[model samples]
Target: MKFNQYIFLLFSLFFLMSNSYAEINIKKCKANQGDYIIFDEYDSQIAEKIIDYKLHNQPEKRENSIIKIFANENSDDRNYWLASIQTDNKAEDYLFYQVDQNKFTEVDQQQFQILLPKIVECNQIKEVPIYSENFDAD
Candidate 1:
């Protein structure tokens, strides 16, 4: 009975620790109006453009909201960056993106948590307008 109790306690502690580690704290930030561009790890011109292009064309679909950007480059020699966006809405829809592909891919929250540390470490999370004078120089 004592041995069983010890095992149960050990399992409980492991479960708690694992759960704590799995939970990643993503800072909530305002999404600035305009474009959110994440440059590719290899090429500056190649970027993932996050914007509501329909703001002028499809006003009905436009939602007034901000997006928080999280990004990081892969460790391998191949140039790749893992990026994620969280909207400033109550629902907080989180979307993951592969900058090289310029497309959003389905990813589990667990995966998000794993890459988050690296994302915050190497990338600067900032809000930039969709249309910027800086873009004109490119």
Candidate 2:
């Protein structure tokens, strides 16, 4: 009986070690000028960085306010990253970056909206709409 218990414990430890290694080997997205947002399997925030850029001919520099990271998908060649970022006070934006091509572009708004629900679902965000009702006599 004691020998059987020992064998079970050893197998459990081996399985846990293998699973931990698998999670550790997941490929993470690499950012160039700005940093990419990373999240864990439980939808907990991991790492994030904000970037600042100035508009052409504008003196004021704006900070890229990233509220949340919706999703990140790697390209077939593993040289590009397609991600959706929710900006402060604005709709979610889709971004594509190619490492080899050295290209970065914002995808269309229509496509971004279409993917919003999927992103929210994957991120396990509980979205709730709030409505305010006002009753005033003038």
Candidate 3:
């Protein structure tokens, strides 16, 4: 009976470790005091550096934002990427990044204007109207 219990405990630990990949990492920004807005919900080791959803989390929660890699955008000769921070309709300022051996590092805007034409389309995400009314019928 004791041997069976030990085996079950070992299996549970192994299972927990295996499924913990890509857990979200949220750190309080000293600038913001303490807010759960900024977070990284991807495993740098496995998350695709190309074309991933990113939440704005500033004013309007989960504002439209996306990350793009150079290769993913069909630029074979260049190694570059940029993020579209939904400041407004068109992304004016970009949050560029560089991936080095599964480690993501933010870099300056490089080759963005040159690669601008390569983009197929940039869809605008409209904010859905929220109505505050009672849903319970007594």
Pick the lDDT winner.
Answer: 1
Each prediction's RMSD over C-alphas, in Å, is 10.6, 18.7, 18.4
For candidate 3, report its TM-score. Answer: 0.26
Please report, as a residue range, the 10-residue window in candidate 3 with the lowest summed lDDT.
123-132
lDDT (C-alpha, whole model) for all candidates: 0.40, 0.36, 0.33
Residues 1-138, candidate 1, lDDT per residue (tens digit)?
Answer: 999999999999999877664333333232333343433443333222433321233333233433334443222221323333333343334444455446554445667556555444533342222122222212
Q: Against the hidden true structure, what lDDT does model 1 obtain? A: 0.40
Per-residue error (Å), model 2, residue 2: 94
**Tens-digit per-residue lDDT, 25-58, candidate 2:** 1134422222333324422211121111112222
**Candidate 1 structure, TM-score to reference:** 0.35
Give stretches of model 2 more than 4 Å off: 1-64, 67-77, 112-138
Give the runs in model 1 whose Cα sits over 4 Å from its true position. Answer: 1-48, 51-63, 72-89, 123-138
What stretches of model 3 exceed 4 Å from their correct place?
Answer: 1-56, 59-61, 64-79, 89-91, 101-111, 115-138
Report residue 117 deviation for candidate 3 (angstroms). 7.2
Q: Residue by residue across 24-119, what tens digits does model 3's lDDT show?
A: 222221222332222234323122333233332243422343223222212222222344333334453443343343333332344344333333
lDDT of 3: 0.33
Predictions ranked by lDDT, top down? Answer: 1, 2, 3
